[model samples]
Target: MSQELIQAVMVLTKQKGFAPEVIFESLEAALLQAYRKEPHSNPDAYVELNRETGAYKVMAKKQVVETVEFPETEISLLDARKIDKRYEIGDIVEADVTPANFGRSAAHTAKQMLIQRLKEAERSVVYEEYYSREGDIITGVITRVEGKNVYINLGKTEAILPPTEQIATETYHEGDRIKCYIVEVKKTTKGPQIMISRTHPGLLKRLFELEVPEIFEGVVELKSVAREPGMRSKIAVYSRDENIDPVGAC
Candidate 1:
């Protein structure tokens, strides 16, 4: 077991918000990668670590045989018995070979691999959180404008407001703050693609639901909505109880 390696793994796990086991697994893979680069290397090297003590070992599997043709697979029966006494002719033995010969390059590569994997994991988490927020209102600041599309920064992600979704009378510049309704959500190969709109009728309904307590509390229900972008919008409402005035509620 490498105490320094275990400490480093713990630090990295905390920094990346990843579990300690994941970090240890990445370390084991890095050790195997380094071991595979040399001559007389075992192709099938397995490693395991004790979660309590952080003790780890690297072992190679070899078949027990009277005569050895391939040294990598077959080993003399006497050497196999030294590691494990229960070893028979058809049995396999595990030989420990944990050493500190992993080069600086291999260590650096392992660090990069860990960082990249953690980033992908974090992105997946953020995507799952935002995916449930589809067809809802999100506030953002206008970051930049490209041709006709505006990019709005929504904390973790930037949403694209296309020309078709923008209100005609609303002119936006950089640093301007606005709230838009999420019209659609798509998962692209890169990440989540959130299509936001200011002209959508759903935005009006959502706004009324936010402004009125009765609509949100189930006292009044929003039936239908229609909008004319920046001009005007009409929303139909109905109440479950006849005593509740739906129009007055909004």
Candidate 2:
């Protein structure tokens, strides 16, 4: 079972691109929750997992006192000395209390919890990745058209091209490759909601930056752009070097 758990972690790490420590921490938290659900469980208990061996143990913390008042949270100095002679009354002792049947009972619950944690991690990753790309141009394939919204597959995630952001004269269809400017990226319960646009003037500026080397290299500055979506567009440009003609360079 330990080997199987380690194997699953390795597989998920490779497939999901998650750090091993993240998965281990999540699994330990899940197991801790499962252990706490058991009858007469110690409230101060924590699960310690061996990353290399995939072995785990449930440990409960008890403070050493001259007299034991709460058996669950306090241990007599004499008892603490029995475990370790250097133990003092003010010290805390952590004892192993892993149940014999804990592995079997907690496996299912831990697996479910780990899956939920990974999904949340994935959403966070996607949100951060897309958030940094806001205001940039991205190319994607149109996957589907639902009502007035066009869904584009951008490899890692999907983007939405709503009616308000679409070109009025242009029609969208599935399997068509298109480029759109990312207007906004919002974190939602479902995932990152990426709002893209085909009619935005930023799209024209981005296209110019991509196709025009002078604009991209800062030799010619693209001051502003005015667009009519599928109709026509105009741009204002200037160059710092008098030798370079900004209009011709573009």
Best candidate, lDDT: 2
Q: Model 1: runs farther than 4 Å from truth?
A: 1-46, 49-63, 68-76, 92-100, 103-105
Residue 202's lDDT within candidate 1 is 85
Per-residue CA lDDT of model 2 for 1-250, tens digit only, reads 7888899899999999889999999999999988987887889899999998899999999899998877777889998888899999789898776777999999998888888888999889888988998989999999999999999998789988999999899989999999999999998889889999999999999889999999999989999999988888999999988999999998
- Give per-residue CA lDDT, model 1, range 173-223, as digits (tens): 999999999887777767778889999888998999899998988889999
Clashing pairs in 2: none
Model 2, position 73: C-alpha lDDT score = 79
Instruction: lDDT for model 2, please.
Output: 0.91
Candidate 2 Cα misplacement greater than 4 A, ranges: none
Q: Whose TM-score is greatest here?
A: 2
RMSD of each: 3.6, 1.9
